[model samples]
Target: MSTWMVTGGAGYIGSHVVEAFRAQGIGVVVVDDLSSGHEAFVPADVPFVRTDVQDREAVAAALDEHRVQGVVHLAGFKYAGVSVTRPLHTYTQNVTGTVALLQAMADAGTTDIVFSSSAAVYGTPTVDLVTETTPTLPESPYGESKLVGEWLLRDQARALEGTSTPLRHTSLRYFNVVGSGHDHLYDTSPHNLFPLVLDALVQGRTPTVFGTDYPTPDGTCVRDYVHVADLATSHVAAARALEGGHDLAPVYNLGSGDGVSVRQIMSAVASVTGTPFTPQEAPRRPGDPARIVASGELAARDLDWQMRHTLEQMVESAWRARQAAEAATP
Candidate 1:
């Protein structure tokens, strides 16, 4: 089995990717700093390297020791709102870390990479349905850092053209990734909508829906929400595509063709958790887009991307995992 090094494999999304890869009989070695990831999230059998991705020597050593053939880069500061205040930290984690990882990959001669990018790169796009062709006008430093990571991959690939080992890479851009693939794994992002709402209910607080008077049909913001499992499978597919010598576009959007609104999500959560509570209405967050959904046609065609789970399924799985985590906590 070919080995792949997942940079943030202990993370919510990365852990799911690790699970998916292992399910396909692929070898996975995880390198995580545990900044926002729990060591328990990584399977006991997998080789776990507890170090920051920015540490070039450590990452390179992990790659060499594991005989890793490819890399799944997911480590970064992902909170967009907090990134506005902590721009330097976001850049260092996402941008500098990516550069270090790429350098390590070059040193190790491991070229294939699958990057975990975000829909934030579009930055409140005017287009109703965002495509890869949409301009990347990243608003927050976090988004900018992600875009820069993509640029680094592109430039590195170009620089390696015609080499014996050309860089092979593709970045997956996604919006509002939610749900859990395993009962043991759950989204822990304090800024994500699903986790925030789940946390509110777990803490006996009413979840707030900011600005419900959006121009959408339900008067709430409509955004793409793909299940974490579905997203993970696509990442594995991308890696396989690269390994198989298939040419892929530089970026692909893993999105729901048409998305669920915030109100619909709240309704699903209420139904799943068996707790019916009207969400508190709050003022519109400045710079919050009214609606931003993307077409997954590119990824669907190339990477087997699809919304395999319904909104209710996403909520149910997430609630179950959250409950499991709470039960296990002291």
Candidate 2:
């Protein structure tokens, strides 16, 4: 079995990846400081180390001890608005943490990596579907940090001499990631729309729609929300490809293939739960794009990836998981 190290395996996306790997009978280890992620979310069988990715020594030791063949780096602050408000923290976590992780990987002879990037790097795209070749003009610190991380990975690979070991990296730029796990681990992100809507609905409250006068047909911000399970599968595929000697720094975009508006999301939730719902409209938030969908054709063709869940399936699954968690609570 191939051994892998997941940097933020306790977080939402990381945990999903961890479960996916374990389900495939692969050996996995996790390193997370639990600053934002929960320990309860991590699988019980997989080995875990509670430590910061910035701690070079700790990360290196984990890699070596686990004999990690590759890494999936997913630990970083992801809130776009918060990143704009706190640029320094965003840089430190996304950029500095990546540097530290790369150094540790180098020290441990772990050269293959699957990076978690974002479509925010595309900023305000002129077209509805953004291709990987689109100009990167990140509008927020979070986006800038991710783009810089991508550059760092490429540069690190390019700088390797013939005698030195090569670093192969795949950066998967994902749009908004949503949905819930079978275990129903409460994801702690206050920015993502899916969980926020689920939270508000469970409390018998009206969900907030930040922008209702957007240029889209629904008059609300539209985004491509890919299910977390499909996203996790993409990471697994990328890792396997790199391990099989794919001599390229493959960059792929993960999306739902279409856009979903805030109003439509509310409608989906209401339909799933069989409840009449209305959203509270608020002024448009900064950095809010009218529509942001990705061209996942490359990912599908190269990685053999396909989004299996429909929009209704995503909402219903999330609702079921959230309700189960609430019912299980004392």
Candidate 3:
């Protein structure tokens, strides 16, 4: 079995990717700083290195020790709004950290990688359905950092081109990842809508909806809310494709061709949690786009991407995992 290193394998999405890799009979080694990832989330059998991706030496050592053939790079500062104020931190974590990882990979001779990119790369896109060809006009520093990371990969591939073993890489862009793949693994992002709403409901507080007067059918923001498990499957697929020397595009969007509105999400949450509290209404957030959905045609063609879970399934699975996490918390 080939071993792949997951940079943030202890976090929610990373943990799911680790699980998916394992299910495919692929070995996985995890390197995480525990900044936002929990050690418990990593399986006991998997080797876990407690270090940040910025620590080039540690990452390289882990790669060498594990005989890692490739990497699923997922560690970074992911909050777009926070990145606006903490641009330096975001750049350091996302851009500089990626640079260090790439350098380490080059030094250790591990070339294949599947980057955890984001739809933020196309900030407030004018097109209703974004494709891989959509022009990247990142708005926040976080989005900019992700775009820079993709550039780093492209440049590295170029630099290593025509070599005996050139770098092979692909980046997966996604939006609004929700739900839980494992009972112990749940989204812990304080800024994410699913977790925020679930956390509020768990704490007996009413959730708030930012806007309800968008140009959409329901007058609420519509987004491509793909389930985390479905997202993880694509990551594993990309890794396998790279391992098999299959050529892939530089980037692909793992998205729902159609999308769900915030109102629809709230209704699903209510039905799943058995909580019937009306969400508090608030003015639209500045720079908030009314609708942003991406077509997963490329991902489906290359990575076996599919929307296996319905909106209700996503909500219920997420709620169950949230409840499990809360119960486990001391």
Model 2: CA > 4 A from native? none
Estimate the TM-score for candidate 3. Answer: 0.97
Worst lDDT run of 10 residues, candidate 2, spans 179-188
lDDT of 1 at 248: 98
The lDDT values for all models are: 0.93, 0.86, 0.92
- TM-scores for all candidates: the values are 0.97, 0.97, 0.97
Q: Please write out the lDDT profile of model 1 over residues 1-330, one tens digit for every residue.
A: 799999899999999999999999999999999999989999999999999999999999989999998999999999887888899999999999999999999888897999999998998888889999999998889889999999999999999999987899999997989999899999998778999899999999999998878888988888999999999999999999999899999999998978789999999999988999999998876546778799999999999998999888999999999999999999
Clashes of each: 0, 0, 0
For residues 240-283, what per-residue lDDT tens digits would candidate 3 score against the true structure?
99999999999999999998899889999998888998999988
Clashing pairs in 1: none
Ranking by lDDT: 1, 3, 2
lDDT (Cα, 0-100) at 310 in candidate 2: 88
lDDT of 2 at 53: 94
Where model 1 places Cα greater than 4 Å from the true spot, the runs are: none
Q: After aligning candidate 1 to the native by TM-score, how far in Å is the CA of 133 from where it should be?
A: 0.8
Candidate 2 on 1-330: residue-level lDDT in tens? 789899899998899999888877888999999988988888788898999899999999988988899999999998887888899999999999999999988888888899999998988889878888888988999989999999999888877646356898989998988776565754558888888888898888888999889898989988998888888888888888898997543588887678888898889888888888778888987766678888788899777678888889888778777888889889
